[model samples]
Target: MRSSVLALLFFACASQAGVIIGGTRFVFAENKKSISVTLKNRSAQTWLISSKISSGSAWPGNDGAVRPVIPFSATPPLFALHGNSENIIRLVGSGAELAQDRETLFMLSIAAIPSGKAPPGSVQMAVRSNLKLFYRPADLPGDPARAYQALGWQRTARGLTVENNTPYFVTLFKLSINGEAIDNPGVVAPFSKRQTPWCQASSRCQLSWQSLNDYGRVMPAVVTSVYTTSQGVSSRVITSASPSR
Candidate 1:
């Protein structure tokens, strides 16, 4: 269930679009009123760009609460970009009241709507894209750099429960138990816990996880072992700070 939820969250993250976005993710800080995202038209044909802000959840539907809960707007709600040209889309936050304790996650969906006619006997294709958007409170405690180190790991009857005790988002790029890969690699929300069905009972097992960096880059993996019977969890950061190129 967790893997399926994460799979939906990661969906369309790498979807192809005629226009390329500037960054892999967007960050909205409490001190700032807004942030901008750049869109570049890479195709030879002109394209229309339409964007919408939606609630970021494991599973978001039309009925789900819209994101930010705070008032925000995307400039040029609709626009056209010529080939090789680029435009900036501004996201402005208007003093929306959100939890001041942790970072809130949102999603920016961009659709490249074709305006003109397709080439002879060719069908025009419109591409859709999704990007991670995070709203960070100024007073939020703890930095993401050290959050992974502080994550709580426990061996449970279902498999494993990884808990995020910090206020920053921790993206798990890799997860494994006893040299066997567990398919729970994804972002673990702040102050939330995730469970995996890797095992049916509490057992001594080796565990490892690689977190994602600020630029949406993968970080080094940390490997450790834990015993179910032990009263405390012992996890050590084995890898260095060097990020993969």
Candidate 2:
């Protein structure tokens, strides 16, 4: 019995480590039938893989209240993976109409459920991985790559004002004003605005941002001149670390 429990523990940890997900993030653009994600199990034990999709910034919890706005389905919802095996999960959009002006975001959860019962008195747990899914509308007004260009930054009395002039979302990974780092990075919704109180009063301060790349990885930070040589805001921008609108 002791040996059985030890074996279960070893396999549980090994199986979790062996699961490999292909990308840090995924994009399902308009006009594409579907996209495929490859999941490989390198452990000696079998894994029962399952998936579900949820919408917005919130991921689906134990409760089933969350629903997907831009519908998508994961094929092979439940599958068994033997040792050193791989499976492809297809994400297909439902052809339902969504807002064409901005991008919609979702979350895809992939769970690895171990097979067999735990040792009589031992506990078993399933390992889970989450990835962001971006649904880009065909008619989105501007290029997401240039979203930063349209962002308007102004020095306010209390802090900084960031205005989004384009239809794309600007996801901030790291933001600093006058060399002071912001507490938490945030997202500026399409054509929206955000204010950061980095100082008590306005000063001749510089601004910079580190954002997400296409792979969902954080890119190197870039210093931005909030104003052009003519003291006007420029219409050129940079990229960052998460899915964009």
Candidate 3:
């Protein structure tokens, strides 16, 4: 008797399987009603593509709870992407009243499932690409390119606290504390603060971090020193020189 078991695999990045997304991240300006994202399939097999917009609160989890509907929608949410063909997916907004002074964040998920049948006793893989979608208002007060340098750092009793006073979300990566790498240095939300337990309270150490721009490119590293004093805690920038790309 033939075995009836079928295996399924999930991938976070679809580029390895021949599907190329046009951009790493997407920004939806408030002045515009919608935006278009291009997807190209380089594989020889046709695939079923489906897209969705969500708050991304329940991702990487198997909870069966139903999620609330978001204000955005993706047109032609489900379609067949033929091999070596390109298609455009339009993301339209419903003019929901988000934070006018700060940018709101969402998630766009694109899943590609193989249309062809898998070989007997083989596994069928499905690739899911999750991209950050930011809704930026028309008139933000500060420059997004230089917002990373304006982050406020303080040495707290628990650890190091990074504050974001700007209207744009700042994502930090390649973070290091005194030449020691910090794992999973996360993003600081717009007008919010995040604390990480990477540095001690009463010690002086060098901290380095790099931020991601709107196009998802990593900018140059910003090195600074975090020192504590009798009055309180403070940070001083040591270097912010951009290296040759």
lDDT of each: 0.69, 0.69, 0.77
Candidate 2 scores a C-alpha RMSD against the true structure in Å of 6.8
Query: 48-127, model 2: which lDDT tens digit per residue?
Result: 89998877465211123234465899987888987788989999988987778776667799988778886666666677
Q: lDDT score, residue 43, model 2?
A: 78
Model 1 misplaced regions, further than 4 Å = 1-17, 59-70, 178-184, 201-204, 230-245
TM match of model 2 to true structure: 0.69
Candidates in order, TM-scores: namely 0.77, 0.69, 0.84
Error of 1 at 223 (Å): 1.5
lDDT (0-100) at residue 209 of candidate 2? 79
- Candidate 3 local distance difference test against the native: 0.77
After superposition, which runs of candidate 2 have C-alpha atoms over 4 Å from their true positions? 1-16, 59-68, 118-123, 139-141, 155-160, 176-184, 195-207, 224-245
Task: Show pairs that collide, candidate 1.
Answer: none
Specify the highest-TM-score model's number: 3
Under the 3 Å rule for N, CA and C atoms, how many clashes does model 1 have?
A: 0
- Best-fitting candidate, measured by lDDT? 3
